[model samples]
Target: MRNQILGRQGEQVAVEFLQRQGYGICARNFRVPVGEIDIIARKGDVLAFVEVKTRHGNRYGTPAQAVNFHKQKKIIQTAQWFLRQKCLSEDKCFCRFDVVEVYALPEGKWQVHHLPGAFEC
Candidate 1:
């Protein structure tokens, strides 16, 4: 329960950060039969499928480190489905996989890192 709250808080922070960076948010918590995507945003002509990982501290690892190869594959699969559902071709509006790392610090503060074009499908 605590982790979920922390994750939610982190995701909120990520959204604000992305908005400040000029990314137009399209969706949050997009879910399909296979899995879920944390956020879908567009920056210019690029559609970004983002995975948000939030952690309390760096004791475990950087939040982005959690996006392993298997996770990347799942995200790619979901992104493909998203494009198909929207009837948009990746060739027309380029697709990108991004990672948003949120570090939940004490006193309700957070440190965020955005990794655009983190991987290709």
Candidate 2:
């Protein structure tokens, strides 16, 4: 339950960070039969599918390091599904995959890092 709460907070931070960076947020926690996307945003002509990773410490590794090849594949598949569902042509618009890392500090403060065009399909 604590982890869930932390994750929710992290996602909120990610959304706000993206918005401040001039990305128009299209959706949050978008779910479909295939999978779920943490945040969907647009920047100019690019459609961004973002993954938010949150951790209390760096014991494991950096949050962006968690997005392995398998996870990337799943995110790509989910993005494809999302585009089709929205009746948008993949070829007509540019698509990008991004990662947002949120670190919960010891003093109850948080840090966020946004990696735009972080990965590709």
Candidate 3:
């Protein structure tokens, strides 16, 4: 329950951060049988499939570190399905994978970090 709450909060912060950076949010919590993407946004001709990671502290490691190879594979598969669903050809549609690290701070504050092109499909 706590983890889910933190994840939701992180995703919201990531959406706001992307919007401020001139990216138009296209989807949130996009899920399929294969996997799920936290957020999807577009900037110009580029489509970004984002993975959001939130942590209250670095007890384990940086949040981005949690997205391992298996996770990346799942996200890539899901992104491909999303493009096909939208009738977008992979050859023509520019796409990239991104990671948004959200650190929960005291007093309802947060620190956000955006890593564009974090990984490839």
Highest TM-score against the true fold, candidate: 3
Candidate number of the best lDDT: 3
Per-residue lDDT of candidate 1, residues 1-91 (tens digit): 9989988988899999999999999999998877789999998998899999999877888888899999999898888888889999878
lDDT of 2: 0.92
Superposed Cα deviation of residue 43, candidate 2 (Å): 1.3
lDDT of 2 by residue, 1-121 (tens): 9999999999998888889999999989888776889999998999999999999978999999999998898888899989998999889999999999999988788899889888988
Among all windows of 10 consecutive residues in model 2, the one with the lowest summed lDDT is 27-36
For residues 3-121, write the lDDT of model 3, one tens digit per residue.
99989989999999999999999999999999999999999999999999999988999998999999999999999999999999878979999999999999999999999999997
Instruction: Estimate candidate 3's alpha-carbon lDDT, on a 0 to 1 scale.
Output: 0.95
Over 4 Å off, model 3? none
Cand. 2 TM to true fold? 0.95
> Which residues of candidate 1, in runs, are more than 4 Å off?
none
RMSD of each: 0.8, 1.0, 0.7
Q: Rate the local accuracy (lDDT) of all candidates.
A: 0.90, 0.92, 0.95
For the record, the alpha-carbon RMSD of candidate 1 to the native fold, in angstroms, is 0.8
Candidate 3 clash pair list = none
